[model samples]
Target chain A: MASFIDFRNPPGSDRRADNAVRATAEPRWVRRTLIGIVLGFFALFLFLPLAVVFQGALAKGSGVLIQAFTDHDILHSVQMTLVVALIAVPANTAFGIAAAWAVTRYRFTGRALLMALIDLPLWVSPVIGGLIYVLLYGRRGYFGPWLSAHDIRIIFALPGMVMATTFVTFPFVARSLIPLMQAQGVEEEEAALTLGAGGFQILRRITLPKIRWGLFYGVILCNARAMGEFGAVSVVSAKISGKTNTMPLEIERLYNDYLFPQAFAVAAALALLALLTLVLKTLTEFENARQLEASRRVTLETTIEPPSAA
Target chain B: MAHKKHVLPGFGISLGWSVTWVSLLVILPLAALAGKTAAGGWHHFWETVTDPEVVATYRVSFGISLIAALINGIFGFLAAWIFVRYEFPGRRLLEAATDLPFALPTAVAGIALTALYSPNEWIGKWLEPHGIKVAFAPLGVLIAMIFIGFPFVVRAVQPVIADLSADVEEAAACLGASRWQTIRRVILPPLLPAILTGVIMSYGRAVGEYGSIVFISGNIPFQTEITPLMIVQKLEQYDYTGAAALGFTMLAASLVIVLIGNRLQAWGNRFRKHA
Candidate 1:
């Protein structure tokens, strides 16, 4: 990879002795200044706000924090968020797997278009994500008359919340899985078929195991966004206390009502969820790196030694 | 190529499921936005989108988003450089923390920022005497935009910088080229495309951002209000067509940015292959 940028040096050219000169290096002071600036930026923008959440949450006392948690409205919002995630995450996971399989396995027209469409939600504003649903399902919307005629409610209801969450999180699983599956390729599946394995057997025994870490990574990301989503869900939720509010909306409600401690307490809980997500993400990334390294070593060995020797 | 066959089973089922889900969940709703906008008639759509207050939001949203992306382009590039080229204490932890904005709930971030930057708060108290108001101001909107977009540039440029060889700079030095000259002529040329892609992506994310900006900006129309906020306000008023019109404009702008980013990325790949 580095060789491609080595315009003056041909491939495999020796230049190790020149490394002692440190010609390409910045001065010690320059390096320190650069690092200091970057660190300060992170401290100011990222770390400070994170610290403020916990500080504000505990400003009154731990007692108030506990009280806030036990509040019926806050508890209901937590339950509502859980219910939404329960409906959305699995739905997206299944869709992601199917989309990944379809995209990575087959050669077809519109493959690029399909992948782009899968990613469409990420680019669109969360507001637009909700607004589109409102256009289709609100009381005066496209299907509004039909839905009302049947006495069915979609907007400001559980189904609309789930849809908004699903829309925002739709791409995470498939996006993570596609690159991993494409890299692993069809050779393993072909070999399995040659051994008389059925489709489900191959999927369960081979494909699933191979992509398990990626799948977990994707699912974790999907779950984090599903639970934390604000804009899209807020648009459709109507913010009716105990009925439509999720955790983020609940925080907004508390903050707007001048319940600062309670708002931050709720936010701190969500912050903890975000922290847990980061930890799980880092673990999966570590596992992914190890898996890739092990596979690369296996490939190196197989290429070096004849297959018949095995 | 079109006739290529796959040995894998369930292709049809998988494709069918994916197509059906994408259509129902993603495409159809987006189409509804378009259809609704069209049904309102072009003249009404134009009037809503071009209304003075709505135009003010476009200025605030696009202007601040551009500024935030530019800031990220500079600072994010530096951060990426340090992470890739240097080893330091807590570097790994800091790198992981960069993704906090992406993972943390935006509403949480919004309030957290408000808490920190409000006049009575830690950072804000210091600046308040200097007449710099952050919360409930355009600066607050800018900060929120910057926070959400911080990760894009760093993530984009890190791999490219890592892949860049130190030997090229060494060679430039061997030829008696100055450090700045080598950086300008050799280093930045290859990195330009990645930086552009990152900046554009950040800009796109910032433009559509709603959650974080709502609290910090105070949603004062024609002041700190963003376009997405305008859409939501329109929806709240039951002005469905107006909301749809704004939504359509935003979606079109994002799609164009994405297409351009893709083009730049492809061009970058081609340049690398030739090099």
Candidate 2:
């Protein structure tokens, strides 16, 4: 994620040198018009809706916002969302780390296939994510009869929500780490191993430290999506008021019931969560850029010798 | 590569864990959907997915997604180019804002969009006198798709734009090429692939989008309903086979799109290398 839209100029590319080539640049009016159009698009589509979330939330005043939060059902929904995130994030993080290691650190057959499979969830719709679970656990599902006989509930329960959330967020950590790890190469881990460090030691001291920023970026993204997941969870949650509804589901319920202020207020809270995710994501990206620069400098200093003047 | 020995000790363990985890969480559930759909005979599956109402959703979903993706392709290119080439006040802020759609929950986006365009809200009120309806209409569905699919193109093309050195344009200019000529002959050639990939990606996402569209579109059957909503509606009616059939159809469509996307990306890389 951080690797995709790196805003900085790439190393060895000097913008100052490029700026000297003014003859190739667009005219003042052309450049200004493009910028204006882009900014206008952003203002109308992106910023306006975001502003409306808060404005609608505060339409009746902060007191209404506070009262909305204090509602019993809303509070329960918040707790349900947190609980789901707590379970899903760690589970997916562990899986992501393992998957990234296997895919990046070793040569293997079907490696490309494995990567595509890991990325499968991203291509699948979130609603399908939940629907699959229901097909496997609902009353008429494959194991539904046996599970019912044993008195175990999966769908319309916490476990179902967690599975749906986990499925949707499955790719974030591994996808983030894969490119970074591939770029870093396996030589460092090999070197650590040759020095008599054990497997865990090498991973703990070298690979983990090397990929921490990417890891954090992945976890942040996964956590945000997990907490805010709606479509998949909604499919399985059955929208039981105080029992199964997550924050996003609760917002939908309130909005559908014409409780506009409450719906917007709940949305405002999630919006804050989204804002926090952006801040953390930006910070991780900055750290990742710094790390890349440092590594590039190290490789340049050590690996490349300056040519002697002929 | 296969002959080389791995220095890592836990390759087997890591690979095993990865396969097991993915199998349990993703593959097994998907197989269940497949098995359920397969259990229903070909006739049943065909009838479920090809029902008139379901077919209308496909039209709405695919039609609107294509339009939205086309719109994003143009604006997303401009945004990516502006981010890479120009620096202005609030530029960084806007760059961050571009990602808000990705981070913000689709449900929140859905409601916020609904509020903003509900005929009495700020933006909606202005358009109301013109008799232009957005909310509860197919146009509203288009808006939701556009909002959710906006970032794909920008993110896809930004790096490609940055990687394109200004030296190429400078050389073209030195050869007496006009600005438009240089852009058409040199710039747009390589970007065509990236832009296509981006558009296809956005289209894929928009086709499967559920949360954002459900609110704004009001889920009116045969009018503004989407495919995913149809699947949910089937599930609610205890039409498990029907839901599975729709899901299977979408899954197959998305798979085909993914394959196409991969081919385009590879072709794009090859073009860039040779150029």
Which candidate's TM-score is highest? 1
User: Model 2: DockQ against the native?
Assistant: 0.60
lDDT of 1 by residue, B1-275 (tens): 36867788879889999999999998899889999999999999999989999999998889999999999999999998888777679888988888999999999999999999999998999999999999999999999999999999998888888777676787898898876788789888998888888898899899999999999998887898899998988889999999999999999999998888888888777766665
Candidate 2 lDDT tens digits, A1-310: 1232122332224556444333466655677899899988998899999999999899999899889989999999999999999999998888889999999888788888889988988877889999999999988888899999999999989888999999999899999999888877777788788899998898899999999999999999999999888889999997988889999999999998999999999999999999999999988999998997887777676577754577
Q: Name the runs in model 1 displaced over 4 angstroms.
A: A1-22, A300-310
lDDT of prediction 2: 0.88
**Pairs clashing within candidate 1:** none
With a 3 Å backbone cut-off (N, CA, C), the pairs that clash in candidate 2 are none
Residue B245, candidate 1: alpha-carbon lDDT: 94
Q: What is the lDDT of residue B98 in candidate 2?
A: 85
Across A1-310, the per-residue lDDT of candidate 1 in tens digits comes to 3532322222232456334233565544667899999999999999999999999999998999889988999999999999999999999999999999999999898999899999998888999989999999998799999999999989999999999999999999999999888877677788899999988888889899999999999999999999999999999998987889999999999999999999999999999999999989988999988887776776677679856843
- Among incorrect, acceptable, medium and high, the docking class of model 2 is medium
Native contacts present in each candidate (fraction): 0.78, 0.69
lDDT of 2 at B269: 85
